[model samples]
Target: MNSLEHLQEKVNYDKIFDCVQCGYCLPACPTYETMERETHSPRGRINLVKMVAEGKASVEDLRDPIEKCLGCMACTTVCPTNVQYGQILEGAKEVIEEHDVKSMAQKKVEAFLFESFFPSSNWMGTLGNATWLYQKSGIQKFVQTTYLTALAPMRLGRFERVLPDLPSPFERAFRKRRVLPDYKLRTTVAFFTGCVMDGIFFKTNQHTVELLRLAGAEVLLPKEQTCCGALHSHSGKGLSAKELAMTNIEAFDLEDVDYIVNNAGGCGAKMTEYPHLFEQGTEWHERAKEFAAKVRDISEVLVELDGLTFTTPVPRTVTYQPSCHMTNVQRVSEPPRMLLNNIPGLKVKELNRPDFCCGSAGIYNLVNYDESMEILDLKMIDVIERKPNAIITTNPGCLLQMKLGVERHGLEGEMEAMHLVDLLMEAEPAAK
Candidate 1:
């Protein structure tokens, strides 16, 4: 069978037909706005899928547009017909992955990333440890000062400047597992410390646990939890994503917890859609539904508690960059804003296009370096207009991307990027 036949079998024809071609998603699309090409727009991509299904286009023709998409799902939010764009996009991605011929180097990298690195906690921990050593042993400084970083890829070298200070392996090993509320415990939740979130942004994960405790919840860290498989799914490794999802479902056996809480918006959104990774009526499908139903973003849980007391006055202006997945997929928007408003002395400034993507759709910045930077630069225009003291984000990817933006725009000391949970922790009473 040809690639078109595979697509015909894999693609959801019904979902593609849902697009009314009204172009409602054009303005909301970062690639559409940046590239100024219809092929990159949500409606255009949907049409391409429709064409591929109808044999008017080949699978190769659909590869570029699908790969270029951030998978942010912003288009779904504005669609008048409520097109299941994400499902269609994922299905097309899976078909492409199966049919497309990749170079040996690309295949090896994908194998390592999808089959080996991401799914292994040991590797992620090693990465954190290696990063810690690089920072602490003066190697990082020497490399930066000597311009050795220039020898690396352009995107990687630029990203090195904004990499978070990862916690040492020793620190991570001894991190707290159960955090009890100082006052009454309103609920119990199992915290899902994501792979990259825990490996790179370990401090933020720690802060999330503390913030949850402060919000009157008993927090339990499930050690068996693996990577959220978001990167895998977005990159078209659906089978790998499903394996990771099943591992997480078994790890987070959520029979007793009130919710399975997560700090990263991308991870949380993927976890909530676990059911989509499985077929209906299957045992894993029912299990995924149960797992997904319990998934909740940290902001959602915090807002519902309404028990946190802020003592320190932030006395700073900050603009929020909503995570596209958190907003469009998880359907969480107001809760994050509500929490920000509750902070004492903090002013929340709204960006011109507040819901726009920061071009950090998972690994987009690394893979499509030039395109991602273009989108980031476009997003920076709104950031420059706000000129807030800090840019706040819910997802780790958005936080890093905004940090790179702050650096690129020469606003380093004047501006900073922070995760929402960290900001909340900073506002908590000093006595802690």
Candidate 2:
């Protein structure tokens, strides 16, 4: 007669049992290593879900462990049984969102982010404009110096340190546009300039497109595409993520392009997994599969092009931080390094535990500040030890998190964090 016995449709009961609990994932899991608690590990979370399915545990029992997860998917990389831990985590999240109790503030923030800002580029632009003015007008400086952000709600104070300056003059020029290569185009691609990638990390997107052009590919920024819905899907809003996927499928003219380029690793991973969102054999499902097939990380696309050449000498020590989505989800580990190695005189230092999460698992650092900082500090330990002039990564979230780490460790004078595409563009001779 337990409520958990009547498992909801959202919970994948069978998948929950896939975990053999052999503890293979223990060393690979960041949260488990940090918290040293059984509840925060993959095996523990999978067991909790299975328990809920079997009426041994309640939805409430699953909340803390699931929420604490970085969703880095490092466990999946080592799982011998091929357990789709990411899928299980997503299902568990859906179940939590539906039945778990949430505060009014939590509900409001989710609504604002998923419903209000994430679905539309206009909202992103509007917010981006305000942020631009805040930085430009010196108000941000005044507030930071005056400690006024401490008075703001929702720990906006700590979050403010992570905000990067918005790109000017170039922001409007890059929106929903197309750029043709000056040379004979080897191929054509549609670029997925994501919500956060476009607004906050706008310059990275620009550099991504420029790199694509230099590699001899025609780039398309289709006007009809919307947010990649990575945040929504990661947060358990499956329906919302599906809606955005459908809109994007219709947006890109797949007939005309050879690849759908995604510079942001998180978005690339989600977009490439679009087929899983729809039931097999549905029309939308077929479309999702086709759309997903074309999605490639910008690094992957760049590596595929044979015409790439770097005349500019970067001549700096650099380390690479692989986004969880890029390494684990997208299964892309080498293309960025291969690209980096291509640059003349650039010292590509291998970061110890390159696959570790930088504490910026999407909005993770924002919601779970203390825990996020713990992970970030661990990451910084490796970063400071490596002592690279710059840390390059494939996703916007990682870029911001590493930048924050630089700021937090007072290493602003010593090191910088940048996107892979930005590094490539900088190393391009024409860019000099």
Scored by CA lDDT, what does every candidate get? 0.86, 0.84
lDDT score, candidate 1, position 218 = 94
Give a tens-digit lDDT track for model 1, residues 18-39: 8889998999898998888999
Go through the candidates in order and give the clash count of each. Answer: 0, 0
Model 2 residue runs over 4 Å out of place are 1-9, 103-108, 169-176, 430-432
Task: Estimate the TM-score of every prediction.
Answer: 0.95, 0.95
Model 2 residue 355 lDDT?
84
Worst 10 residues of 2 by lDDT: 1-10
Candidate 1, position 315, lDDT = 89
Relative to the true structure, candidate 1 reaches a TM of: 0.95
Best lDDT goes to which candidate? 1
TM-score of 2: 0.95
